[model samples]
Target: MERSTEFLSDIDMVVGPRGHRRWPDAVKAQIVAETLVEGATVGAVARRYDMRANHLSEWRRMAREGKLVLPAVTEEPKFAALVVRDDVETTPDPEPRSPLDLIFGAVTVRLDAGTSAARIAEIARALNASS
Candidate 1:
């Protein structure tokens, strides 16, 4: 006697909580890239994937925003180019002091003991400008 074989349909496939389905990652990536980068309609991708259009659309958006859980193919290079030994090192600007420094006596101020109010105002302006 010959035995009959049954095959599972696309609908029979199950999707996991982590967004992985019975379909291969490469296939899923192709579908997503087609819809997002290729500008293919969601309905078209959905038909190709044998899924609902809305679901495919949501998946595409999620993939674009990096919300989908997918395995990394290769390790991306940390730096695009290597720095030469002779290259000069540039120093970054120091972080600005807190505003409290201006309010409190943290900042040193140098002015003549008998300096006029106008002179003091000018000195304060210069200090503020320098800051």
Candidate 2:
């Protein structure tokens, strides 16, 4: 059999430090913080730091899970509690309603204000069937 050495000519040697990189927790938190800025994105921040977006996302997850601690914010967030009391009585709807009257021959039917359209239609249907 003849030897084939043609494929070896195209291979180029690349020698450099290429392996897993160790990122400090503080640096990871800072990169994660950059993503929190308004209009900033994970891919953009990761590219800026020469890292992968997924790695930055993992750091963000770590920060969320308390595995990583982010720097404190300059301004404190304020939240107001909304109190709902079950002891308070419910009030009727305040919507204004107009009276309605239905007349069938010599008989007249009066409906209360705010009666639903479906109920009115049902009553009218019943009255028509009875007539």
Candidate 3:
């Protein structure tokens, strides 16, 4: 009974500082990634990290949104054995067209991807002045 009590006492470990425990993005991402392993559970991972499952979930969400940088794997990634296929289309497809393109009667103004509205307006004014 005394041994059981002693063991139980040791189970509760300090999570961190008393109030709000602020974890760095990198650490959160690493812990969140641990939950993705084959047999790992959120609850178990959270407990190991001394955090709540809900908090761990939030970290996972951050990772999904690219707010956190996941830790890199130590081992090189493995590739499947290359098998020669008979009907696989190996031809490289042509690159897709620009995302933003404006055409004003033969005047094809191909805007670069992520072209700002201000730049677009400037282009429009230049075109108007020429005509």
Against the unseen true structure, what C-alpha lDDT does each candidate score?
A: 0.61, 0.77, 0.74
Question: Candidate 2: worst 10 consecutive residues by lDDT?
Answer: 7-16
Residues forming the 10-long window of minimal summed lDDT in candidate 3: 1-10
Q: Which parts of model 2 have CA positions greater than 4 angstroms off?
A: 1-17, 75-131
Tens-digit lDDT track of model 3 for 82-128:
89889987889777756787766679898887789999999888888
Which TM-score value belongs to model 3? 0.44
Residue 40 of model 3, lDDT score: 95
Cα distance off (Å), candidate 3, residue 73: 2.3
Candidates 1 and 2 compared by lDDT, better number: 2
The model with the greater lDDT, 1 or 3, is 3
Candidate 3 wrong stretches, greater than 4 Å: 1-17, 75-131
How do the residues 1-131 of candidate 1 rate in per-residue lDDT, one tens digit apiece?
Answer: 54222222333555679956575545566556667543578887676665689877776677778776544544455666876886789789877644312232357765545566887777678777776
TM-score of each: 0.33, 0.43, 0.44
Best-to-worst ranking by lDDT: 2, 3, 1
